[model samples]
Target chain A: MSQESQPEKTQTANFEERLQNSADQIETTLRSLLTDAPRGTEQLRPPKLLAAMQHGVLNGGKRIRPFLIVEVARMLGYDQAGVLRAASALECVHCYSLIHDDLPAMDDDDLRRGKPTVHVAFDEATAILAGDSLLTLAFDILADEATHQKAEVRAALVLGLAQNAGIGGMAGGQSLDIEAEGRDRTEAEIRQMQAMKTGALLRYACEAGAILAEASAKEQAAVTRFGTIIGLAFQLADDLLDVTATSAQLGKTAGKDLQSHKATLVSLNGVDATRETLNSLILEAEETLAPFANKADVLIATARFIANRQH
Target chain B: MSQESQPEKTQTANFEERLQNSADQIETTLRSLLTDAPRGTEQLRPPKLLAAMQHGVLNGGKRIRPFLIVEVARMLGYDQAGVLRAASALECVHCYSLIHDDLPAMDDDDLRRGKPTVHVAFDEATAILAGDSLLTLAFDILADEATHQKAEVRAALVLGLAQNAGIGGMAGGQSLDIEAEGRDRTEAEIRQMQAMKTGALLRYACEAGAILAEASAKEQAAVTRFGTIIGLAFQLADDLLDVTATSAQLGKTAGKDLQSHKATLVSLNGVDATRETLNSLILEAEETLAPFANKADVLIATARFIANRQH
Candidate 1:
């Protein structure tokens, strides 16, 4: 991002403005990355899957994961075009998850980011292929053309991403969410569920940033801590929104969690308690950044924005 | 495979024999790799996702992809755990694709390799997440572990796999298949479909073997040729089987392609034409090996087996 948006406060911005500014740049680059993607993806070369993927990945979302990568990279003072590549890779994975999550066999949703879901826009088969392709393409982008000369950092980035996205991370969380459907669970269980499903990817994002920056282990841990807390708060906010926010505003079929008989933070802890949890988590995330030597404002404010964003 | 049980001179020595031999060996050491899976992957892991993943991967199917990886590695005389690691990673991707393909939104398959489909065995959401996680985990297997010495090699492997599996490769093929659904398509379109979906991965598998073996670019191209032809033959056989085989014997739905009004090689070209094309392709594949100056009898036999296989 341009210096004007650099979060002058340096200690409290969570780099939201800075991150968004940088992320906007990354998104633009990502668009350039996609101008010829249909021809570029040798394995998934079908026009339908290409358009579906472009729809899923190119359609504007918050670009939060990519921003996190760039943010942490900046904190380490090591971001470059390489960081943008990693950010795009993370975006690809995140977009794939969204596409798959919206499938009829899964959440069965029909809309995403205020647009028709991939399955709704295309066919379910195409959506599944699109999601599958995006997921595969994400790693390709990260490993092939994404990384820089530092092999260790690249490996660390790939490892962090893989671990979070796999059974140990996003997959595990999603599994837990499915397991808890229609069943009441403890706050701890709910927390675990959210951590894996949502927190894991977010954590991966922060770690990718740290990795790109070649941050010290301690720094990586701090960012991880921040990611964990913020990810949970984000989930809690999402749950709360399901109850309080309308479909027109949220642009999603809210209250679907309840209709699915799923026990979210709102159902388990109630709106007020969930809000309290979100507040506490947000603070914890901010505090976690204290140990890091770099400017911690972007991550901090990112956490706050996640917790309180009106959506 | 003790070399004896591998495909040999006997006509009774079928692809199943070779596949089974490889499957047994890989399964024997499969658990060893899980030790390296993400540390927190199993904690609060989704039972539904796990079930779906296990259903697709652990279910009794011939580990063709893994076998090919090992076989190619063996051909290069690089007989360490690199081949196995690559095999495990390859299996993870194949399993992920199977899980997604069986979803109600995709192929909606109820059975695979003579077992319940992931969606049938578990819920669709679990299946989707399971597939997603498996895919993410494939990279984790490569990135988390310190198998490949050169990060470039690891990156290449990851890229190769992703390109083959992503929107342009297998997913691309699947997209074409979906688009062609209920419509007649030209032979070129059919070839493009098969090349993307099946050809991309097989070629990647071939290239992966060369890469892991540290084979030269020229050697890599040769294996790629073999893979391309074998992949086409494999798809042709699948098309033929859909028309000629019994569901009971095939271990899954039979003639479903024709029933669904989907076009296939057998549908586009007559059975005789497909047979001739299959022969020519296999011959081309075998000829690709000639430049290598090594006797790839097993690989050649492997190509021929692709043509004669029933299911």
Candidate 2:
């Protein structure tokens, strides 16, 4: 029994190490991107705004979105500097959303990732501008010659990101979620909100990998399906953690969603049903990547990690 | 004397008509873009969010930035539908900045262009999201094949827009301006702040025209210089108006800059000197376009009109 469990333990350790390594690489890349003005521009980085952007983004987190991009691209046989650069761009969008989400007019959180939020660390105006800058920087990174040799790939990435992150995607989802507060939301409405607010970026993370890899339509569709399933699983796991975890564990204000009467799948369905749904999502995500066989092991592990993560 | 002034009057009327026609076209394009989801996307435009975006963007303004793109591109002999589309994208970035700058945490203005600001009309959260969505949509429009058939041009627009709108440009400039409030500023600091905050996008507006027309580097440089000089003129006129014009004429609050102790060239150099400076700027702008001869008559007129306008 001890020998049998040893191999599982080794796999878990290996997965965690890979996740940590990716997060560290992303952190380094993001730090450089935020610190330097892009080459050949006379634009001077305003120190205050730059500091606020650094604070909002450089704070430690799991870097799950970037990890997905890197791992999926690797699985698709396209491991290049551009892949990490594209990953960093997606992470910028994610960080910018978090900064805006924590504003006084939004979630009103003071702490994120165990530190004062950007608004608290700097000021609300600075925070807003920082978020704006980061969002703009994401496109700047994607459109650069460094992101891809082919301008077509770069343009496609820009369009995809703007579509997912703009009016009908993340921002739209945020509007729906804010409006949903203090009102009983139908399950579909809640699901749609969650999909937009969180799932869109997650799905884009995977789609970007396919785009960077120049994957065939069939392979791209498979990876995108995997992304969609994991996106749902990620949100379900988050809902569960919000109900079950503490602020200390989550590094944020937990249970505030309940206090705000925010609707979630966990609130609509019982804990048991939600857990069951998460488990099924994990299976579906695994099945979606089955054609890749062992090449998709990292992504399969990533899905399980997202579904079972404590924070 | 009446006969001598007749052609000048006619030219003025022609310029005004051209400006108005461009503004009307921009209004139509913006309304359509905001109303419909982009083709081939599963994304849904949330109704409340969409309404806020339309309100923020469709509020009447001069549409000066779009006009610059169209006029400059036309002057360079590349009038096309893509020019107007790129113009609309620049307008989106401009409108988004206005929305954010008016938020309670920023400039805290209640009125814009004689209408309630987005934050005042919709809630602050919605306003923030609307601004974000519009900003994101700008890149989306630029990246589309409709904006430019050449992927290189599309990518260049995206990169230019991002650089001009990001930390070192408009958003960074906003941070500097906000930080400078209630404090004395040196002439150079104020100039740098204004350049970043307002000058960057205006410069991009002209450069985008050169880019769209595929002008020579020298011609692009000439247009960019013209843009820079006119950008200074635009701001100087704005500062002059803030001191001289009534809210009824300006369509927004006036004298608020003085009330907030905001630093400006008009505040530093006094009205007479600032007026002198504005005249010199107009001359420099006209000289910058001298190589284009009569082809630049409209733009030369635009510089004069910008400096001499009452509001």
Candidate that scores best on TM-score: 2
Kindly list the per-residue Cα lDDT of model 2 for residues B41-127, writing each as its tens digit.
437889998999999999878999999999999999999898989999999999999999999999899999889999999999999
Considering every candidate listed, which one attains the maximal lDDT? 2
Assess each model's interface with DockQ, reporting 2 decimals per model: 0.62, 0.77
lDDT (Cα, tens digit) per residue for candidate 1, span B101-188: 7777678898887888877777777777777877877887777545577777787787788778877677777777777888788988
TM-score of chain A of each: 0.89, 0.97
Interface C-alpha RMSD, model 1: 2.5
The superposed Cα distance between candidate 1 and the true structure at residue B247, in angstroms, equals: 2.6
Screening candidate 2 with a backbone cut-off below 3 angstroms (N, C-alpha, C), the clashing residue pairs are none
TM-score of every prediction relative to native: 0.90, 0.98
| RMSD per model, one decimal | 4.0, 1.5
